[model samples]
Target: MILQSLVRLYDELSRQGKVAREGWGTAKVSHRLVLDEAGNLTGIVSARKKVLRGKKEKEIPSDMMVPLMVIRTTGVKANFLCDNSGYFLGVDKKGKPERTKECFEAARVLHHQILDGCHGAEAKAILSYFDRWHVDTARECPLIQENLEDILDGSNFLIQVGNRDATEIPEIRKAWDDYFKSAGEEGNEERGQCLITGKKDEPIAILHPKIKGVQGAQSSGANLVSFNKDKISFCSYGYDGEQGKNAPVSKEAANAYGTALNFLLADRTHAKVMGDTTVVYWSEHAKTVCQDCFLGMMGDDSGLTDKELDDILIHMKNGQSADVSGVTVSPDEPFYILGLAPNGARISVRFFLRNTFGTFIKNIAAHEERLKIVHPPWEKDWIPLWSVVKATANPHSKDSASSPLLAGSLLKAVFLDGRYPEALFQNILRRIFSDHDEPAGGGKPEMFKVSYVKAAMIKAYLLKNCGTKWEGKIQMAVNENCNDISYVLGRLFSVLENIQQSANPDINSTIKDRYFNSACATPAAVFPVLWKLANAHLGKLDQPRAVYFKKKLGLLMDKIAMPDRGTPLPHRLTLDEQGAFVLGYYQETQARYAGKKEDK
Candidate 1:
């Protein structure tokens, strides 16, 4: 019956184009079949094509492929499958193949062993023993020992018995439902709510609502009200006993008083919203005070009693203060209170105002600019160094040869920093120098001389200090610099390569003779070599030692050669006029010495 089922499944697979070539050759492919003690088939396993070797004469029954398909078809996470090769079989933590031929052959033997008995509960129990043993062997398979635990625990199994009446099993459904509902709840709670506004909505500003209350008795007092979003406006004009019994104050003072009142109202309203009660103490000549004796207060919430208010007022009155009005309250109204000064005392009221819209806007803009300046995420996507260099070299723009060099240097400092991959570095160099339309001229030679001098200096520094570890990186730097020079020259100059190889002899030897002759014969060539040596030496020394060598080299070069003029001189000679003059003197002396030796 098991063989019949296997044949039927293979036939269906062939009809669906899932199995290759429908004839006898198809069954010849090895299929990894998983079975229980009852000889019931559990799964089929296959291998992917990449792992398969030899001419594609016939596709193997892929153990890996079969399980992937089974997963899609059955919606189960408890099946096991493995390739036919012992090297790729699945196993349990104990390291044994779960579906070995020995286990299958034994189960087949047991199937016959149990067939003689009556097809009752006792026969089923005997068959179940074979199934359990098959699972145990897979868990302990030696071929997949390392991954045995994963196979046993990680893989899923599915039982698709047609007309088996599994619906009658209440325990299984309840267990499955409980597991899924717990998982669903966990997923939902992981996403939390917004904390600031206590709402799962977009960000919004918090505004304080104003309150209404009884107006004070002063004639100059006026009601305060919100005129627009985030703003409060009011007017104030009151009696001054000093001028006469009911003399009104100046319009300017009233307007100023009105403005002050608006600010005071906003402040008190905000304080109340923040759960702080306020007390207002009014003096004709003193600054405004809150209910808690908070004079010129901001953000303070400590409460004050009537006795404290009395003491504060007494102190103000002793300082020649006039009439005072005191009220203890929360920020409940848009009304203002005015105090009249008896006879000739001065009168003034002061209050805090909400920050202006323009001020807040300016603050926000400044903050945004600061954020952009500090964390510039856009810089990561900058064009490649070669592209930037080539663009800067175009004659159409106000670009020069030096522009590209500077641009390349900037790019090195900003992006590469010696960490970029080798392929990327090569790609950058190729892009920069691949297109060259200009004719090779004196400018080309001049640019080569300058670039070569700089490249040699860099090479010397790397070799003298970094040793073998620096070899690959230095070569890349040299190649990149050479590409840049090649673009400038409008043709390949093998001379730079020769100089580099001579400096590090293990490298390719193209222009070794030319480099040697130039170093021996010309001050221009020798200067770069010497400068590179000195600079490399200086870099490896202490600060004081570096300064000493730098000064000595400066003096030595000054006495040897004259500086190049009408163009930018080499970096070594450009350091100082004394150095160039010294180098010039040395060059002539060396030439005379060489001529004398030849004559001899």
Candidate 2:
């Protein structure tokens, strides 16, 4: 089903003139080898394209063209009509003698094969150019040396018909197509009902191309499907090592899906690497709005402004969409989302969803609503999931990858409206226990470890369990009207901590530093002791501020009813209650800044 969706997308893309025609593959070209009608290498031209990344413009190899790669593991195997320095001229940076000689030979053989099919005068003249060709004279261009391995050995280079133009000749393309068709015939082709295309008597590719751009996969890439005898019991199924015989996929279907997926993976706007997984999305038809909006939510596209994306989301929240650049998104359009992760050589499907665009937006909007919280002034109106995940990771890295399973589960929950992964709540709690109130400064140790991102994640998790009655009570900021015992206790704890801070502004440690875990876990054990300490701290303050804070604490405490001052607290707070604790502390901190501004 995954491949089918991609195949259908490829077909639609072909119709829309966005992809190459059938039997051709898209390759990112760094430079082109320009050839004359006589097949002489006249000049080397760049195929570099410019694109804007963030606020800066940069150049990347992006002139996509049609070609088939010749992937020989160790030896030279030239492309049908295009290749990089390694295959065309054997220009290794280290100048390896054996590889250089071998690649030249491969090029010689490939051109001879092309010469054999040519009957015209141009073809014969091309053969003459090859006769006088010298591999020793071929020099590597400076562009090929930029990140040597990735450019010369890694990227695909192309062949153009002219010295400077990337345009192709009709006759050459037709001749190449004829040769390509004859070469694709695999002997002993499988004869069975194909699973994907449902055709019979068609060839099936046992080894498909390496799937690229997946995070943590093999550097060379990984396979989507394969079963070895050592790994699985049903390897051969009574056939002599005939791979992929059981789960039949026709060669046509295989190529179509592979090509389409590669197109998506190579495009940054369509693919997002979130920790262990790479997610790719597309609509079945020409719905640019759907693709852009979906990517916009995940913070993958750099072209759209934040407010523009946010406006689209807001309109979506209302079950309506505004026109965007002459194209308006409709909720009824079909959409597909696929998440893939690496498991050794084989690929793992984290999740796949097939639904209308409306359903996708609805589920996502609901999740955003759940995560709503008053953020710092510097924070963006919309938060990416990666930011939430990073708060749970070690603090040194600006871009820490979340756990693979956790990232997948969080995305699934966002798009499915299902229960969140169990690890998210537990991980947040673990961070809370180990962290302190460490405000950060230039290369200095933090004085407040509680971050807005982490607090927002805590709020989101708790709000998932918040019942309808607590709507107004559980809000973006401090909610004084809330009557929930856990929430009220959390708020009370915040006030007490603040009084300690007010009394000793320069103190290295406060009640929070010594008693935060205990305060949230077993409030009964910590609250009574903290209240006595608060009186001492308040007495150190001026008489006017002392009376004002005392009255505020007394009113908040009045809302908390207990049989007696010595009543025992619950042994430990549940996950939902833990969220309340975090939110109350976060809100209290924000209120402090607000009060200071008012005083000024």
Candidate 3:
């Protein structure tokens, strides 16, 4: 299914002139080999430009459409028009003059065979240049000496005739295309029915093109569908000692899927990172509106304000078309989201989702709505997924990343409207317990421990997974009418902590720092001790403030139904009950300062 969808994408993108056609591809060229009308080596020029990468500017090579590069591994294959210094200039840091000379000769023979009969000045100049350029004397040329270091660094170069790139000439392009099409058309024994296209007697690709830009994969790139002949585990019974033949993907189908996937991975605007996985998404029918909408929903670089994003999401959820970034996008377009992870020399599929654009919008809207809660005034109205995942990490640990697999799992739950992974809730609880007592470490004190994103996630989880048990009990804010034993205990504990703070304004540590985790787990043992401490704090307050806090505490305590056997507080709370306890404390604390300006 993945390959079939990619093949269709390749066809659509090809018709839109977005991806390279067969026999052609894009290469990053760092220099250009300039030639005169007489085909003499004239000069060398940088083909790189400064572009912003993150906050820093970098000088990177220019991507040019050239003949497809050969899949080389310890081989002397040469590319047409564009290649590294060893193949084009006969000079490199390989420390093998014999091998370098072989590379240059192969390129010379290829150019002569293709462009010799071409009737264009660009073609003639290219042929003349290769004929006159001798490998032995290449280093002696003044132009080569000036740029020798950069060339020896193995950056790719393109051939330029006079003032134009040789590949841009119409006659030369036709010659290369024709030669490419007929170069390898002879009979082959590996021909079979293609698994992707189901076509009979087609040549199977011995090797698929390398996939680049996958995080943590080889910089040279990695293979998605690869089999090693040397490894018996990868060999099928009938296809021993064969690689791509084992899969039986036609050369054309392989090229189409590889090209399409590479195009999506290379695009920065539509590709995003989810933990260790690299995510790439696309629309089925040659439309970028889906990409725009998805990025906007994720709070990424979608060029849309928060209000604008909310408006589009609303329109889509209502089954209406939305004008996103001035492009009208229907809600019913087919959308695909693929997650790729690095696995040794191969890429692993973390997750793949397909749905109508409107369904995705509705799911995301539901997710956002569930995450809604009464947050601090300074927090953004919409919390991005990255922020939610980060809330579970340890701020003091050096490699404090949440589980690498959790991002994909969480995203899958959101997209499918399924139960969220239990790890998300458990990790949040662990972090809350471990980090709740620590000082803010030079940051704002109010931004400590239980963040708005964390609280909202807990509420969202309980409401979704707990079914009708927590339907009306879990709300966006503190519910005074909620009298669940664990919840009321949590609210009472927060009130006691606040009373301690009010009595002693300059106190270094409140009861929360010392007793929060214990109080949440064993409320019966801790709440009675906290009630005795609250009486002391009430005596320290003025008469008016003392009466006010006492009355509030009495009302909260009365809501907790006393048991006939013993006290109202339970001996211990369950994991789900512990989550409600945390939410109760967070929401009640927020309510205390709801209208006041919080000190940062």
Candidate 4:
């Protein structure tokens, strides 16, 4: 079903001229095989026309549509019509005469294939270039032979004829293109029912193509599906191990879906890398409604101007019903989001979510609302997936990649408005325990406080697991009236820390630096010690300030029951209570700074 939908999208995108043609792929061409109308080799000029110093290489734009990469083997599977100078022009690195000869012969075979299909003026020019060409012992081609040893292995080369690019030459481009579109259909290969299209007598794909640009996968590319005996454990009694026999997918259908998915992955505006998972999304409509706005919501859009982002934020804040660029989103249009993680050569489908565009917006909107805390003004309004995941990663690890499974589960829940992963709760708690409490180090003052993002995440996690009864308690700012013991303790901890700050402004270590984690986890054992410390801090303050804190602490103490003056504090807090503690700490700290400049 996923491949079928992707194939459908491919057809639509091709009809709109949005995706690459069947026989072509994007390439980083660095040299041109300059030729005239008669195929006379012309001077080789550098494709890197502009050079920048203090950088490894110049930044140059790559060509969009070149001949597809060859599926090379020991038998030499050379491209028929369009290829780089190395494959067609016999170019190779220095001191590799055998490789040079092998490639030159491959060029001859490629030239022969092109001639069989095309008989036109430009075709005649191509024949002239290779037919008269002979070996030069001195290695005299100005283009590739000049710097053969230094050329990048995949450095692409293209032909130019009579002041027109080879692609512009009608006969040259069409000849090979026609051959590719018809190549797999000519042979007398056994046919099977296509799993994707259910078409009878269609050839099954021997090997599905590679999916590149997936981080941590093979640089050559990874497979979306595979059935190799050595690599996979599962096998089936099929039509004698024929290609795609167990799970039949026609050659055409496989290519269609593969092509469409690769196009989406290459497009930065359409694809997003979240933690270790790659998320690709699309609308059923030909062109998405406010595509940039849609991308900004799911992925990070660093290109978006602050004003542009603000405009979209305002629209989203209004329930995504506002129009942008005069384009109103049709709420009924279906959208698909596919999350994938790379396994050894195969893709693991993390999540496949299909829903209406309106519903997607709402799910994200709900998540945003949960993250809506009274944060410091300098913090970003747009909290990307990276920041959220990074907070949970261990800071001391060499590779800080988030757990792929956990990240995928969390995102799926956000997209579906379902329950969040339990792992997220545990991971954040681990990070809090690991770093939230420590002595002042390297003579630097402790700035230990609950961050807005972590606090928001805690609220979201609790609401997800515990439901809407927490609605009024978990909010943007402090709730002074609620008397949950954990919440009260958290506020008290912050107040005590503030009193310590007031008493000794230059103190390197505070109670939070020493006792935050213990007080949060086992309040019964720590609060009695903290209350005594608070008394000492209160004594150092002036008369009016000391009186104010004494009364404030007295009232907070009244809320929490003490059978006989600290006789029976709760022994340990549950995870939900811990969340309440974190939120209470954040709200109180934020409350302290809310109206300093505002009142002025």
Candidate topping TM-score: 3
Q: TM-score: which is higher, 1 or 4?
A: 4
lDDT of each: 0.30, 0.72, 0.86, 0.73
Q: What is the TM-score of each candidate against the true structure?
A: 0.17, 0.75, 0.77, 0.73
Per-residue lDDT for 284-359 in model 1, tens only?
A: 2222333233321211333544455445444443442223355432222112222211111212222222222222
TM-score of 4: 0.73
Kindly give the number of clashing pairs for every candidate.
51, 9, 0, 0
Worst ten in a row by lDDT for model 2: 162-171
- Lowest lDDT sum, 10 consecutive residues, model 4, at 230-239
Best by lDDT: 3
The alpha-carbon deviation from the true structure for residue 177 of candidate 1, after best TM-score superposition, in angstroms, is 13
Pairs that clash in candidate 4: none
Candidate 1 accuracy as lDDT: 0.30
Q: Give me candidate 2's TM-score against the actual structure.
A: 0.75
C-alpha positional error of residue 589 in candidate 3 after TM-score superposition, expressed in Å: 0.7
How does candidate 2 score on lDDT? 0.72
| lDDT tens digits, residue span 86-118, model 4 | 565565555566776677677776766866566
Distance from true position, residue 165, model 4, in Å?
14
